[model samples]
Target: MTDIDPSVYANYYWVSSQFYKFRQEFSDFYKSALLYLAYTSVESLSDSFKLDLAFDLSLSACWEITSTTLESCSHPIIKSLLGTKVEWLYYILQAFNNGDLVRYQELCVYNSALRAQPALVENEKKLLEKINILCLMEIIFRTIPLSIIAERTKLSIEDVEHLLMKSLSVHLIEGIIDQVEGTVHVSWVQPRVLGIPQIKSLRDRLDSWLGKVHTALLSIEAETPDLVAT
Candidate 1:
């Protein structure tokens, strides 16, 4: 395996992707191709090939796979992308990884290179849906009002309900929607490989929780001096 040309793997991946595309098995194609790209020695490929592979993988329908790529910045393939024509592609993927709908929209509108991708142009609606789902994941509240979801996702209340239903159906999120209350009570969110931003978000949440606990303890001590041992 060490002696074989890296292009051999790249060529095989490309051919397999085309086969899956022909069958309209987009999810399978993305999963397999991304795994191949992640595991292979992408640095051995030409710079042109690396750029093309990065672009192709960035447009994957599987947000989990594309988003995970952001965590691999140290990988040769991802490192090779820096300071190149497609460097914006890294930020584009970061937007998706961070669930920044506004940034994603800005990139789409302002980046002519992104707009030129026929795959992206054709699947704009699907991409919107994906970004909305990502936005939902970023919400910290387990139980949230539809209005809040609408505000966060930039969707109408009706659309928010539909999006929640779609997310539920796909098992992206485990939750129940209360139509009368216009709220969703989420029990779980699908876990994925975390990138730097997500780790930072987790750290922030932990700090906030600790602060709240300290405040509560102080309040308890002040109000219930008789029950406090200290």
Candidate 2:
């Protein structure tokens, strides 16, 4: 039997550690894939092998993974894909990350090469539904009227309600939909593998909440001086 290198085992454990970090933090599958490809001594492999990896990563980004965000596209592994045959795949990832439905539609309309992918073609409706769900997640914070969701997702109010129901059923989001009032009161969103922009958005929301709490405390203190004294 040919002897395997001990370093291969070390690299496998390292990649596993990175994946664990990803689950706990904001990193995604692409980032972990990049780490594996970069550190696994795959530099000696042929271009075809790298291209295969890119294609698999793109497919995972589009359908296989639960995460819609692809914030790490600027990484070297993805960046090197520029001007390559899979360049459209890069833009597709960006569209998903940003929840740009119009851009995604445009790509599908213009890029016949993208349309040729059997998996994407077969799952077209599923992909559209996933993107719409991602669009809802991007826009929703706490509570939103159904009309606004319809406008944002480019779906009818009825469709919006159905979408929310599907999202709820899948545990993608936890919320209550008020058909009477035509609104959704979202209590939680599933944590996604985020990029820097998403992380900053989260930070800004936290700061805003802190500011509001501080203002409320000041108001309470001013209105109840006797209570504070007691």
Candidate 3:
């Protein structure tokens, strides 16, 4: 094998700095792929650079990026890195990957409070917020009252609304926040890959929905046999 470049480590900042300063040049697909890579690199880099690397992805932007690249960006090493990487930044990445509200909340409550490690306390709070915001869109089904969402997500009522508005502004989900009734009326969850279990659940829901439609159609046929036949 050829000798590796020790000079690259000598100029590590010069190399990693491009990921920060030149983000404008990357397409969203590339940006989304890079988020995971950059997140993984945080521990290896110096303290001063961690937050800058972390904030390169906002909550909604994480969803947007993941949507485009989730299927085909196929990084061979990321799967291996994902499991054992339990550092501060990867916690946020793990939550984003799942889009599971319950899991994300559990992570926040466990790590973001007085129990947080001294070095990780500040970053844990930020990671909790990022995961909460990232997973917000996936939890809506029909109309859910905002109060319950706040309770589950461990956010205040106002923060729930703010998070909803942020997702709406990014076009992550198309929904209405009814202040008078205290409900979030969601019509759609943006398209993204579903894990094996989610796919089964979705399949069951679609079957139930189709059964509802079939019963309605049968009622219409009974009422207007001639019209239906024609």
Candidate 4:
């Protein structure tokens, strides 16, 4: 067996520590797969290899059994391991694996929040702004008013409204009122929130957008001069 990479441990130390502490909080299958993967030394492999290993590990653990609700142990394990990217991957795999798509998608949404890290530079900030708009695209189907997104994301109401407008402009989110407030009609919860496929799709879109933003920022930094004349 190869010695684990100290750098992998350094890069993901906090996440790995959290995994260990909360490992038991997860169901059985996820616990087992995560434990196995987490124990593997990422030090020896290239980053690409590590990512491929994660994807392959998920595939190997997933099985064909159409009737199994996403309540299965493997779903969370996949989410924890892959973040939002895995959610879409879960849906793709579901067509082949016979796992529950809806439940797994919902897990992806919660996992999506973890994907929101602070941007290190200006272009990254732009990319996050765009990604945030994309993530909120489904709000069009949500019964709640545009105001709630701000609360959910802890942004000011204006920021939320701005995001909503951007999402609407891009056809990411649309809005409808099934009930009249003065007429006192009851509104049903939109089932969009829990869908595993949607969450996974959203996560992938966000991840890709952020990657571009990060790359753009890096290029800018590379071209900037160290000092400027007054």
Best by TM-score: 1
Backbone clash total, candidate 3 = 0
Candidate 4 C-alpha error for residue 17, in Å: 35
Which regions of candidate 2 fall more than 4 Å away from where they truly are?
A: 1-48, 68-76, 226-230
- Tell me the tens digit of each residue's lDDT in model 2 across 7-86: 67547755664575446332355555655665555466577766666665666667644453453454445554567887
- What TM-score, to 2 decimals, does candidate 4 have? 0.28
Q: What is the lDDT of candidate 4?
A: 0.44
Q: Flag the better candidate by lDDT, 3 or 4.
A: 3
Candidate 3 per-residue lDDT, tens place, 114-189, comes to: 2444433545555555556556655678899998788767789999998889778877778889999999999976
Worst 10 residues of 3 by lDDT: 72-81
Report the C-alpha lDDT of model 1 over 1-230, residue by residue, as the tens digit: 47877667767877887787677576767666666775476656788877766655555543443323344433456555569877777777667767789999998999998888777788788888887888888773689999998998999999999988988888778989999998999998877667777789899999999999999999987889666654
CA deviation > 4 Å runs, candidate 3: 1-75, 82-94, 105-121, 225-230
TM-score of the candidate numbered 2?
0.74
lDDT digits (tens) for residues 1-230 of candidate 4: 38976455544643543464354322333334344455455465565555554554444333312212223224333443445454444553442232232334344455543244222122334434543443343333335554555544445766766655554454444554222331111122222223556568679989999999999999877767653421
TM-score of each model, in listed order: 0.78, 0.74, 0.57, 0.28
Residue 219 C-alpha lDDT in model 1:
90
User: Which residue pairs come into collision in candidate 1?
Assistant: none
Pairs of colliding residues, candidate 4:
5-43, 88-200, 105-196, 140-174
Better structure of 2 and 3 per lDDT: 2
